[model samples]
Target: MPWEKQFDIDEVLEKAMTAFWHRGYTATSMQDLVECTGVNRASLYATYGGKRDLFIAALKAYDESGRQALFAKLEALDDPKEAIHRLFWPMRPWHPGLVSCVAVS
Candidate 1:
């Protein structure tokens, strides 16, 4: 039988994305990814290729999730102006808790 993954890939990618978002790609090391993801380096490599590949995956995941959420919110609103306004000015402030967007830092 094929080796089974012990952890949730989505959860691991979310953690990895958060780590990269906070520390940036250059500052975040494999060890940091390992710790943040709670997955061993070997497993991460085997599952996601290398750090670069993992970063790309994380970025894609972020973009897809953001788009889905935006669509859902926009679809719920009847007024185009309200949708545009809400898109530009969210109800809540951007912070770690909200994970509003991908930060350069």
Candidate 2:
């Protein structure tokens, strides 16, 4: 039988992304990914190939999420200026916190 993954891939990627976001790709180790994602080293390797692959996946996921959020905001708002403003300045009071763009960083 094929092996089944015991953890959520999305959750793991999110955690891994957070780890990379805070520490950066060079600074974050496989051990850190395991600790942050609650996944074993072997599993992470098997699932994501390696740290670079995992980082790419995480970055893609982050970008997709940001795009979706931006589209949702744009769709909901009637004013184009408000949508543009929100996109440019994400740290507005309504937002929970600042999320620096991970793709650029």
Candidate 3:
């Protein structure tokens, strides 16, 4: 019998990422992840491995989002120069939280 419960991975990742972003990797504990991600300790370990594993997953998810946005900008073929310019020089460039996360890695 499967004792596991169903959960939303995207929701868990979002919560875990926020916790890690706010607390930083060293300070964020497994208990914090459990509270923040709403995943039980045993299930968290079973599903995502350890804190390091979860951190890596969060970082990877963050990186992939940025990459996909960049690719979207690049794919706008209507005006290549403008698209490139927008990518490099947005009106409001870089989210403060995202910058901090980038600095950590």
Q: After superposition, how far is residue 9 of candidate 3 from its true place, in Å?
A: 0.8
List model 1 lDDT by residue over 1-105, tens digit each: 889999999999899999999999999999999999999999999999989999999999999999999989898999988886777566446553653444422
What range of 10 consecutive residues in model 3 has the weakest lDDT sum? 96-105
Model 3 misplacement above 4 A: 1-5, 73-77, 90-105
In model 2, the runs with Cα more than 4 Å from the true position are 79-105
**Who is ahead in lDDT, 2 or 3?**
2
For all candidates in order, the CA lDDT equals: 0.89, 0.90, 0.83
TM-score of 2: 0.75
lDDT per residue, candidate 3, 32-96, as tens digits? 99998878999999888999999998888888988998888689668877775666555334563
Model 2 clash pairs are none
Per-residue alpha-carbon lDDT of model 2 for 11-94, expressed as tens digits?
998999999999999999999999999999999999999999999999999999998987997889999888767776755565
Candidate whose lDDT is highest: 2
Error of 3 at 77 (Å): 5.9
